[model samples]
Target: MDQFEVMSELYSDRSNWVDVRRYPSTVTCRRMLRLADFAAADPARWGSCRMAFEVPELSYRELAVARGVSHTTIMRHLAKAEVGDAGDFTARELDGECPEWLRAVSIRFEAGCTSRTYRYAVALCTFAAAQPERWRVLRLAYECPELSQEELAEVAGVSQPTVCRYLQPVRLEVDESFNDLEVIY
Candidate 1:
């Protein structure tokens, strides 16, 4: 009845009745698209570099190998891509970094992020990771998607008048240089 045995039993059978959360890959992909759009909005990010070049984890060497370019060209491309602080590197943006606790939760969400350690922190992180449009939608929806306006207000911990506040547009703002990520919204 302890945790280990429960997990072990669950793992032993393909047909175990235990619940497995399903990810809407489309939603994730759409969110990524939206994030890309947001990143692109900064004119500084424009360059010959493709999306692959700005990816957080890819090193200059890896990029060079992938593009069949010299390391210098890779570095140059990364600079042109405006990915931020090419001299330093961090895997996740500060505003999108989930706590170690939530790392496991992201796995449950099937999102390859740290949600188990962060819980709702993960949700906020993902929201921050999204594009402006996606962020607007997610912020409002998380306040309370299923509730009446009054109820939604309570859920969002805001005044009822604020439920409709979601319609007001807000721009997405990532919190730090991509190189030294710390925490998500």
Candidate 2:
């Protein structure tokens, strides 16, 4: 049997066990039924495009180039095929207290880093952040300005390169200027 026929039978059988109120409204159900029918009508277009919509990393522009269609057409098909909760699912995945390493990677992403580069940087950062003793050593480095970066790395039990990566974002100032600007004002 065709996909629409199978879908109808499946829904009919399900409605017998499920509450009518719980089932989607007839109008909404028909819309989805129409979408399925439309997709089944052109399996080549639908099947080839489904992966682009399903895969989070694939962009519509990339799919458009592959499918030889305008991005708008690809987007329209994706919108029709997408479940209402798809966006919510993605949001829920990212909506939580992110670890420091993830926050650092997110910063890099915002700075327009490539995905591969961001992934590698995140892995490195995660490795460094996982070392509890490194944080202690970083604290000591902050407290003791006389200590060299190499010396701090030795105390931290991490490589000098790792220590440099960890401390790169830190800004330290000695405030050597002693002029009283209030008098000039």
Model 1 lDDT per residue over 54-157, tens place: 24356778767766778886565445222122232223423557333443231111122222222222233334444344444445575456767676566556
Query: Relative to the unseen true structure, what is the C-alpha lDDT of residue 88 in candidate 2, on a scale of 0 to 100?
Result: 24
Prediction 1 TM-score vs. true: 0.24
User: Lowest-scoring 10 consecutive residues by lDDT in candidate 1?
Assistant: 2-11
Q: Model 1 off-target regions past 4 Å?
A: 1-27, 30-144, 169-185
**Cα distance off (Å), candidate 1, residue 70:** 31
TM-score of each: 0.24, 0.25
The residue pairs found clashing in candidate 2 are none
**What does candidate 2 score in Cα RMSD to the true structure?**
23.9
| lDDT, candidate 2, at 49 | 38
Point to the candidate with the largest lDDT: 2
Candidate 2 C-alpha lDDT tens digits along 86-179: 2222222256653323422311111121222222222322333344354455566767989898998887788888887877664332122222
